[model samples]
Target: MIKVLIVDDSALIRSLLKEIISKEPDMMVVGTAPDAYAARDMVNRFTPDVITLDIEMPKVDGITFLDKLMKARPTPVLMISTLTAKGADATLKCLELGAIDYIEKPKIGVTEGIEAYRQIILEKVRTAAVSKVARRTSTPATVKQQSIISGTEKIIAVGASTGGTEAIKAFLLALPANAPAVVITQHMPPGFTRSFAERLNNLCKVNVSEAKGGERLLPGYVYIAPGDIHLGIEKSGADYRTVLIDGDRVSGHKPSVDVLFQTVSKTAGKNAIGIIMTGMGKDGAAGLYDMRQSGAYTIAQDESSCVVFGMPGEAIKLGAAMTVCHLDNIAKTVFDYLNVTGSGSRL
Candidate 1:
């Protein structure tokens, strides 16, 4: 059975979480603690496989405790935080610090929302239990934009989930400001994606922003899909523009990777590149295959570089990925493919 420890400052949250988690047959609640000291002792005693951590703890903040825990124990952690802007920023930082995933606590109907989201919370914990937890690593300095042939004919359609925030950052960080127009759909909430895009814009040479739809896909610019909407592309004469599709969840996710890839397949055909990064489940496997069939080059992150290889692994098995490589080499590989195919000028 998967062992879990609940660390929260609120008794209501702790009790609610314990009740929800204990209902799962494959996982069990080992213990619950209201503070860092109590949590530290429980962690040593139980050595739980997964931890549900609350960010707004008193005395010792969740981030500081997380940093220490990751360094000393390296156990898989799932953060429970509010979904406000401040919470989004802290949760993103926690992901960078090696927390596998997070769940947003409700702002208004605390009991109702938490109870309603029990399945999702349990799923995150399950993903965390099986996920690989690594100690903190230093961030790479942003690479400067180098001049390359400028045009928007070629588009890059990227999709990721789970560990995607950092993977997308690494991929975009390595690209020059003059790289091809790129679009991404990461499985995240509305507020979080805006923050994620802003963070990338500050660090990378490329201009990154949340998609407003109808804007021309321009070279040196990146667009991120807003949460709760599907982001697709449409051909506008010789150029492509972003379009947001309002619909129910596809592939069990709003802003599904498959929706984006399918649009790229039909609109850009051989002129596009499809990248399926680290995420859980098969959200993008079939869509990646569709892109390949449409003559778009497709790539997947190799298992060694993926925190959870479910998505890419499924794609690899289905022959959707034309090339598989480590996360560190994806940008180089994309450039190499483009250069050989004469799609764009290289640096």
Candidate 2:
């Protein structure tokens, strides 16, 4: 059974979360607390498998407490965050501080969407229970071995979920400033993708921003698919441009990785590089296989470096990846793949 603890200032939120978690046959709510102080006591007594931590509380905010918990005990934590710009930034901080994942906190007195909210909460809790927790740390800095890929026409399609916010950041940090055009699809909601792109832009050498369809794909820039719309690429005379596709959810998600990967296969063919990163579920497996079948070079993150290993593992099982790399060496792998001649190869 999975043991859970709920920490929040609001009595209602604590109660609601408990109600949702308690219904699961394999989960038990070990305790509930109104602040970090009480939560610390419960952590000692219950030693729960997962914690649902509220971002905003009366004292000792979520970020500070999360840092403390990671340093002291290192239990898996799932942040309960609002779907606001400030909340997005704070939630990312919690992830950096070692929280396994986050769930959107429901509005006060929420009624109409209670069922959906319960489902999401339980799913996140389940994920958190099995997640690995460790001290706050940065991805190892691996210097770029060379300058840049030879052509602006080469394309990269990256897909991730779960721990991807950091995985994507680590991968992007390795690419050269003038590397090939990259189109990314990460599982996020409507309000967070713009902020996530902005966050990556500030840290990496490459220009990163949310895709606003019709923008021409170019080297030195990375475009992230907007939260709800699937991102695709198509020819615009001689150059390629972003396209916001409207369709039913593919592989259990909007802005699905499968859509982006398959789209790249159809449009760029062998000129594309497909990367399946750390994530939950099998969203990108079939599409990644399609890319490999179409002669595009494909890579999957190795298990030791993955937060979940589900997505990349699926792709590997399907015989999709041409190369399997650790997260730190992915950019180096890309550099080795795209030699100076501009025709791709693998090391």
Candidate 3:
């Protein structure tokens, strides 16, 4: 059975979570904590396989508690947050600090909505139970930063889901402005991807935006696949362009990593670099395999740094990835492989 610890300050919320989780035959609420202090204590006692953490609580907030928990005893943590803008930002921060996933709390006067949220919460919990929990590692403070490539251009296609929001952010923030033309497919809702793209644009040095059909692929710009559509890269003579395909969902996702990777493999061929980041399910594995077979460099985030190793793990098992890297090192690894001075460079 999958064991869980529920941490929230609200008594009603805690009771509601308990009721929802208890209904699952293969999962159980092993413990409940009102605040971070109680949570820390319970961690030592129950040793749960996963945790459902609230972003807001008395004494210590969720983000702070998450950082502490990851530092002390890293485990899969699913954040429970409100649907407000502020809540979204906080929940995103939690993902950065190693939270596996998050679910928005139901709003007041939405009794039926709360029930729906309960189902989502349970599903997220079950998913988290099977995900990989990254352990905290200490790095030297004086580690030298690597230099960016002076002049090089290549196509970089990235796909992710579940814990991808923060994983992609962390990976992209390490990239230089002149890195490459990046096409990203992150599983997100309609309005959410736009907000996520805007957030990435603000956080990273590159120009990040939602991908539009037939747009010219340009360097220093990142195109995120819009929700409910498949993003593909099309070739035009010597230049490559973006193509958004509207079709049935592949592998249970619209903007599937498989679809994006397959298109990149066919269009860009050996000129592309495919990256599969942290996520649940096997959406990108087969496509990443195809990318590798087509001579495009493929990389998968290692199990040690993934919230859900399902995608990358599947790719690794299929021998699709040339190298498996930790989340913190994935960007550098990609840069190293694509650097103009390096042997793997196509430009």
Candidate 4:
């Protein structure tokens, strides 16, 4: 059985979480704490398999506590955040600090909202329980000089989920500022995407920002699909532009990687490079295959480097990927492809 620890200042939220977790036959609530100090004590006593952390609390904020917890005793943590931009930013910070995943708290009808999202909450907990807990010690993606923009006219398409935040970060950080025009879809909620893009922009040499429809895709810039929207690319004269559409969930997610990949296959064709990274489903497999058929170079993150080898594994199994490499090497691989003329294999 999965043992869980709930750490929140709200007694109501704690009680509600306990109720939901207890109902799962394969899970049990080991303990609950109202603050970081109490949560630390409970950690020693219960040794839970998973933890649900609230972003705001008295005496200590969730981010600081999470930093300490990961350094002292790394464990899988699922953040409980409000559905506001601030909450979204903090949740992203927690993920960067080593939290496994997060669940957004509702702005209204707390009890009913929790009940409505019970299945998702439970599923996230289960995913977290099996997730890796490594302290990320990579230096920040800080560059002093303006990155030299390569004049190569190529389009880069990336998709990720679950542990994609860090994977995406690593990929983007390694990229030279003027590498290529990049479009990405990372599974996330609506309010969170903007903050995530902003965070990446501050760190990476590339100009990363949330995509707004109709912007011309340009080299050195990365367009991240906004939450609750599907992002696609279309040819405009000699250039391509970003497209955001509202639609039903495809492959069980909004801003799906499949949507972006399929569009890239049709629009950019041979000029595009598709990379599917760590995620939890087959959302991008067929699209990646379509890309390969269109003569675009396709790459998948290797199993050893994936936080969860689900999405990329699916793509490789479908023969969608022409090359498979570790996350650390993806940026270099893309550069290698751009540097070579044609008919090249994995780097």
Best by TM-score: 2
330 Cα displacement, candidate 2 (Å): 0.9
* lDDT to native, each model: 0.88, 0.87, 0.82, 0.87
**CA lDDT of 253 in candidate 4?**
87
Model 1, 250-342: lDDT tens per residue? 999999999999999999999899999999888989999999999999999998888788899999999999999988888888877777674
Q: How well does each candidate superpose onto the true structure, as a TM-score?
A: 0.94, 0.95, 0.80, 0.92
Clashes of each: 0, 0, 0, 0
Best-first order by lDDT: 1, 2, 4, 3
Q: List model 3 lDDT by residue over 1-347, tens digit each.
A: 98999999988888878888888899989999999999999999999998999999989999999999888888899898776657766776787678888877655455867766776787788888887664434431221235544233378899999888877887777777766789999987565677788888997877899898887787678899987699998887667789999999998888999999999998877878999998888999999999999989999998877777888888999999998988888877776765444344334
Rank candidates, TM-score, best first. Answer: 2, 1, 4, 3
lDDT leader: 1
Q: In model 3, how large is the Cα lDDT of residue 172?
A: 76
- Estimate the lDDT of model 4: 0.87
Query: How many clashes in candidate 1?
Result: 0
Give one digit per residue, the lDDT tens place, for model 4 in 128-175.
887776459575443322323344347899999989998999888887
Which structure is stronger by lDDT: 3 or 4?
A: 4
Q: Name the lDDT of candidate 1.
A: 0.88
Reference-based lDDT, residue 174, model 1: 88
Please state the error at residue 256 of candidate 3 in Å.
1.4
For candidate 4, what is the total of clashing residue pairs? Answer: 0
Model 3 stretches with alpha carbons more than 4 Å out: 9-13, 33-45, 58-60, 71-73, 106-123, 130-132, 135-153, 236-238, 339-347
